[model samples]
Target: MPSDAYRDIASLPPALRFLAGGGEATKLILERDWSDHPLGPPEAWPDILKTTLSTVFNSPESMILAWGDQAQTFFFNETYFPLLGPRLGWAMGAPFQVVWADAWQQAKPIVEDAFAGRSRHFIDLPWKLDTDRGKADTWFSFSYSRVLSPAGDVAGLFIFTNETTERVLADAALRESQEQLRLVNATLEAQVAERTADRNRLWQMSTDLMLIAAFDGTIEAVNPAWMLTLGWTEQALIGKPLFSLIHPDDLSHTIDGADEIAAGQNFARFENRYRHADSSYRDIAWTAGPGDGKIIAVGRDVTEEKIAAEALAAAEDQLRQAQKMEAVGQLTGGLAHDFNNLLTGMMGNLELLQLRIARGRLDDAERFVIAAQAAGRRAAALTQRLLAFSRRQTLDPRATDINCLIFGMEDLLRRTVGPTTDIDVISGAGLWVAMIDATQFESAILNLCINARDAMPHGGRITIETANKWLDDRAARERDLAPGQYLSICVTDTGTGMTPETISRAFEPFFTTKPIGQGTGLGLSMIYGFARQSNGQVQIHSELGHGTTICLYLPRYAGDALMPEEEEAIATAEAASGETILVVDDEATIRHLIDEVLEEQGYTVIGAGDGAAALKVMQSGARIDLLITDVGLPGGMNGRQVADAARMLQPGLRILFITGYAENAAVGNGNLEPGMELLTKPFTMFGLTAKVAEMMKYVGG
Candidate 1:
């Protein structure tokens, strides 16, 4: 070390140079070759060097300069003048801790490390300083590094520092923003998952058959309801063409629907047939629409609706046919009565001639006598059948044990059903009795047996059973029946069962599933009419390839009569009387026949072609005893009105009304009152005679 290096140290400010004692200052000059003279004491040198270093670094207060082998305080720059309070120019030979007493405890470790050859780095250390200016909060970035002497040994320490508080706050704000963004993203993801789960639950819980099909018509997915509705497993439907499940006739439409869906069109509603797992076709109503990459279809089976529609149509047709038949019956009944009158006259005249010939007054022959009688019998039989069809024939109702009735007719039933079919009776002991017309019941049973026989052409078993049933109010409401005890006569057959279409129309008049001439299509219709007329109901159940069960529900007889043999016959004879009768009819032959029959029955008769003529005749003061008039009379006054007016003239007057067209709107349709008897047209001469006599007796009474 030369005196030249020592000279540079001595050139430092006096405050720093004074820190070096005399021996230290001399040692520094000798080691670093500073100015040769004994320049100053070591303390003075430190003070001078501290002032010089601060001036060189352009920092006033808080400046430090240290060199190798020195733990002493070296500098207090001109900036320290304000901080040192009235001792601004004081010598800088104080210890480092004493010089920075407020921060010395905190800075000691850093200072020590630096003197030991560790480089010091800046750090933000918080502190409060008491000064003449004021007490203030300050943050400092203090750095310390080792200084070297001329021999390269540790000599002193150097420190550089800065104040930094604003930078630290800015970093905290950035971290908060990042945390907020993470929360938003997490919430969005959670919402998406919840929505997906909700959608899956809704799809599973739905009851309608639902399916998702690909654009190519292959089934991509099906809900549990699909399997439940169609009776198909999930695996059976997957990857299968959706149209494959449609009925053959509906396959083309199904394909078209898929094409429309793929083209982004939605079908709001459509009806078609779908094949059930059991190979039957079910009528289905469905809505299909486009969805994400697929077609979604929802549907319900409407087979019952289709069946009910068919049944309604058939019922309407049967009603129309029944009306027609009733019209014909009226015509026939009138004709029979008129014809019988002509026969009565002819037979009376013929008997008179025969008696005259036997008394030897011959002329004309006996040939006319036989022909008239034969013709009369034939007309009577025709009238009877018409009456049967109309359900207007008199019934001989009896409390008949069905078991005996069926057993007695077993031979007849077997003969009627043919040799191939087997008849089985399963009537329970102590079976209930039904109040019914035995002949009609026999006819109905025979007709049913024949129908069953026809259904089983290849041979089958027919089971006839009779049982008592109590229909409750709830059940009655469901079935549209009157709640009461009923006698249920069931005829079941193991035969070729009818489809819904066939079964629905099975009871319609002239609507037959059998080949032409094989059936008249009147058997079931007749049975239905008979049941309804007898205050009963008929229900038929049949399924294709299964069997049929036809049940007849009749109100149980609550009266006393028990046996068919003990039952009394319906009265056919009319009351005897001789009262004036006025017969009004548009048909001349009918009018004349009625006049002749009534006159033969010992009642005075007057005829009229129309209601006006009858009224005019009555107004003319002819003492008409009974007004027997036709419902469909010419002019404004109908039979009912005519009877009303006639009764006004003659209060408490008895009327025997007649009609060829009973459905005449002017007649206020349905049956006439018991006091006003109705004689449907095309009746037998005997029927007219009896009815007229009955009315006369009623008036007399």
Candidate 2:
């Protein structure tokens, strides 16, 4: 407990804190608040001990030292932590003998030797210690020397140790091998007498299949290892030609291998397949060499290894596909926004223009107005398809019977494709049910049939078939799908088949084999999105000049299809009813269009530029019968949050949220919240007015 002992300890000679174990060891020691330590603190250590311990703690080689007859531990470097393991925590500043009590006998002598003014060095000495691994046997090459006191008497044990277990064991094996060689030369005659029985025992116990085949490839000898690998008895295998048991696919290869080993030239490491007792193939890798005009071979079953390698390759392919889809979705998210705005303006203007023509104000411009309106509506449809392909489509999935769903579309398909094209609807017996949005499923079917019709120039056959399928792990991985029961609907057409290039990009949005302007390229992409969102998959199979087949795999739902009662459409006649409505949107054109249309219907409408403005209007005591707001707004608050805030002021506030994106977390499934209604943008005037009336009805307006 010398106060000045540590005062100059940092001043120095590498025996102080100049550098300990790469200069960072002492940093860890100083940063630690050692007030609770039994030794009080580093500041109170004796001068002679402080300087000597500091030098040992910093030495690059693993080192530790114990001071006093109590064996109070003083230092251990970072390099020595592995040797002490769990005991390291209590070993610092602790009695070394008690901390390493599990190895006390071996450790006591080393410490006592140093304290007795004697130094000891040993090579590859074994010591058992209670460590992290519990009673581990470790070996070290070490030297124990006295840590002398300032009076030149032994004060502590100075130890330097390095783990040499691996090196020492390797050296032992080499020496054993050398000794065996010397004995082999001295007893060559004795070994020859025992060789036959020894070889027979080794061959019987070996895990690798040992075989001796004639130069003509007739097997003369086989080991018990063959029974473990191929499950065939010796009597069943020995007389048979070796190539006969080889897999048919691998028989020719085996024959060629025999020819190579026939010339007495040794060969090694050839792989092929061998038939198992179960009539399946096990991949086997073999090593062969020439022995006394015969072929000596050793074979090992590698079936599991082969399967694992295949699965890894398939997983890597799936990862690459997922990355490509993610990249495409990100790039199109912005395009969806810009295109949605343009669509809103175009659709709003067309609606206004059509309204004028409907009022007989532009009787002569009716035809022109109708054409432009049709084109504008098509552009809006295109935008929706883009969103669908990006998995942003809002879906209302329910239990659906795909069998009845497809059969019910017969008349529509005939009408669309005409008489020259033949349509056959084939349904599976006891078809598995699926969970899908019925409306979207119908549209997807129509899209596929339309594509089929286009493919057949002279009008060929279009067949729609349904079947139940269960995909196992390997099969599912190949398609990047989960292993489960699935309902597959395949549409096949006798038409000009698509090339590999076309088939590869078949599901990509805006990618089509048809000439420009002839195809929007969104049909298959939209179907792909619908399937993915429904937790299903779409796959295409085709060969040039052999026609094409498009398959839609939907997850099988075990529950019976629940038929939702269709609600009679609300009449727009009572849409106004003198109710007040609040409309919030960032787009001026859309807001103005809504305000104009609703005002004409006799409802009082309040317009806001964003969520904030809408909240301000409500705060100003405006009576709102229905809240119609865009989910994404510019004033820092989205429609859902604004609606939530407004509800605090008026608990009975009814909400109707709209967005161009298929789905948003806030408005999922259009059930926004209690007293809330959900709608998507680019909606028809009739649809919009009907929704407003429905929400108003809920409020008893």
Best by lDDT: 2
Per-candidate TM-score against the hidden true structure: 0.40, 0.50
Per-residue error (Å), model 1, residue 92: 99
Tell me the tens digit of each residue's lDDT in model 1 across 56-101.
Answer: 2345335555433444644444333444442232324445665567
Which runs in model 1 stand beyond 4 Å of their true positions?
1-443, 456-464, 477-485, 494-496, 530-536, 543-547, 555-578, 600-602, 616-626, 647-654, 661-672, 690-699
Candidate 1: 10-residue stretch with minimal lDDT:
21-30
- lDDT of each prediction vs. the true structure? 0.67, 0.77
Give the C-alpha lDDT of model 1: 0.67
- Could you give candidate 2's per-residue lDDT for residues 568-633 as a string of tens digits? 333333546888998999999999999998888788998999887888898999777888989888
RMSD of 2: 28.2
Error of model 2, residue 555, in angstroms: 2.5
Per-residue lDDT value at 144 in model 1 = 83
